[model samples]
Target: MVLFLYSPLVSRGVAQSPLGAPRATLAAPAEASFAVGQQLDANLAAATAPLLAQGPSSGSIVTYIAMLSSQNVVPNAPMTEARGVVGAALAGDRLVVRGSFRELSSALRDYATDPVDPPNPNITSAFHIHRGSPSENGPFQYALEVTMNSTGRGGSATGDYRLTPEQIQALQNGLLYVDLHTTRNRGGELRGILMPA
Candidate 1:
């Protein structure tokens, strides 16, 4: 009995003793709309010319500062705090798909799950949320998004595309819903909203 016990123990020890810890493959974080975790003091001012062009109203400046700073803040609890995909304002004609993730596994989850409501029939490209989904209210316009590409900080999206403008006299109105896509899955997600530029 003693020999058998010792043999098992020795085998277990050998099994535990490996050459080294297994090395995990790390995927790069998605490209950020702007530099994240970065202070918007000088760099931010230099980067956003559109904001600069709007003139120096205090409210405008304050809003711009808030927008830049909020990129680093954590989101409120109960959202997909786990590593997942993130979106950035649709810039130019293309949308960039990005995420703030520590590992590739986190970023990929967004792509696998049913993120789009009414279940996007065509998930071959970016997914879309249904117009009747709980997110929409009577006449308010919501932004629509689509993931086009990715990089190190996060990604980009194109949206707020006006299919039709809300006319004051019209009874029916349309709003934009946010949407996203994934290029490569990152294993984690970040906490925040990516507003349009």
Candidate 2:
């Protein structure tokens, strides 16, 4: 009588050892796929393309865009229906700011004084870029200082300043913001967060 012993490994198609006994092969450990990571990287590149495109060929550049509004101001200052668009571009080490305003309060125009004035009241409305968010009330290091027109209905400003890498990174991370200041509200009448374009 002949008796045959069958091993489970042999049934699963595992190879036999030198002694004719089936051997089990260890399975590889599972790893997280890199496909998801690659997708996330692509998405981030797409979102930041507009801002990075402003950079100069010799060096890096970053761009920030903002919408001027009263509701974004710190301490919640009330303002007229004035609104504007602000654009800031940092190329190499130079930072450039530009913006246009509209529907500004008449009080701002009244407060604004010409340089010829005897007292020379410098109450001109101006634009500024602060280091922190709208709620944080950080220091204003870059000033656009755009003067309003006679109508107080519209104005524009352009200014440039030197910026370090840290400051540029802050701007890229949304840690910077723009503010519109008037003589009536020296603390800033309107504010907006700067974001990548």
lDDT scores of the candidates, listed in order: 0.26, 0.56
TM-score of each: 0.27, 0.59
The digit string of per-residue lDDT tens for model 2 on 3-110 reads 233222211111111133332322222122212222222222332343355543535444555667888888866757666666555556666666666666643423
> After superposition on all CA atoms, what RMSD does each candidate show versus the true structure?
19.2, 22.4
Task: For residues 1-197, write the lDDT of model 1, one tens digit per residue.
Answer: 11111011112111111113332222233232232322222222233333334444412221111121212222222223223323321222222223223222123334336344554434433323223222322222333233323533233322222223232112122122223223332211232223222
Q: Ten-residue segment with the worst summed lDDT in candidate 2?
A: 9-18
By TM-score, the best candidate is: 2
**Which portions of model 1 miss their true places by more than 4 Å?**
1-47, 54-61, 64-104, 109-115, 120-188, 193-197
Alpha carbon lDDT at 70, candidate 1: 18
